[model samples]
Target: MIHEISAVAFRQNLGEMLNQVQYRHDSILIKKDGKPVAALIDARLFERIRRMPARFDALCHRIETAYAAVPEAEGLAEIDAAVAETRAGR
Candidate 1:
């Protein structure tokens, strides 16, 4: 379960919160004025998401290269057609 705490409380217990996140894999949601402002999560999960953008950009570049000969509008239409066909089967 996630633990929710105010920003002021979190600042006072920074070390303890870090330990809980590192050792127990607990997520702490930090709030300011009752609105969620940040989160303390396991390092492993953070690293995975941190690296995703680069990998995603590379994949998009490859797809764009493969579809280079097709006009932008036509390529989008083709993609829409493919998605519609796949969804129709389900």
Candidate 2:
């Protein structure tokens, strides 16, 4: 669940805020003059997000198709010649 706290209050109770985040998986929105300025989120939450699998295979297929539409270079001979030149340092 999300909670809101003033920036001053958050500063005063920073330890408690961090403890709450680690134990409860709660998110805190820090407000300045009643407007939200920042968010405090637990590291574990980001870990979980990173571990979750992507849900849309169609999205991946679309991206691959778009990438494959790009034209290939005209000749590998030019690339090989450049590589040989680089290896010779000439």
Candidate 3:
């Protein structure tokens, strides 16, 4: 579950919020001045989130190397074909 709270409210109920996240795996979205500013998520989830950027970079690098020898137009045409096939529920 997810809960949205103002910054002030979060600060005031920090202990309770932490308990909720710790025991129930709830996520807290913190806002300031009615605008979203930050979030409080489970530690394990946070760890996974922290690793996403490195994983994404590695995936991009692998794709780039795999397609390095392909011509731009040919690559784009293949991508378009694949997208169309997927959209058609192939």
Return the clash pairs for model 1, or none: none
Q: What lDDT score goes with residue 47 in model 3?
A: 99
What is the alpha-carbon lDDT for the whole of candidate 1? 0.95
Superposed model 2: Cα runs more than 4 Å off: 47-90
Task: Arrange candidates, best TM-score first.
Answer: 3, 1, 2
Candidate 3: tens digits of C-alpha lDDT, residues 1-90:
999999999999999999999999999999999899999999999999999999999999999999999999999999999999999995
Cα lDDT tens digits for candidate 2, 34-68: 99999899898777766665535567778668767
- lDDT of all predictions: 0.95, 0.84, 0.98
Give model 3's TM-score versus the native structure.
0.86
lDDT of candidate 1 over 1-90, digit per residue (tens): 589999999999999999999999999999999999999999998999999999999999998898899999998898899999999999
TM-score of model 1 relative to the true fold? 0.73
TM-score of each: 0.73, 0.55, 0.86
TM-score for predicted model 2 compared with the true structure:
0.55
Residue 61 alpha-carbon offset, candidate 1, angstroms: 1.0
lDDT of the structure predicted as candidate 2: 0.84
Alpha-carbon runs more than 4 Å astray in model 1: 83-90
Candidate 3 residue 83 Cα shift, in angstroms, is 2.7
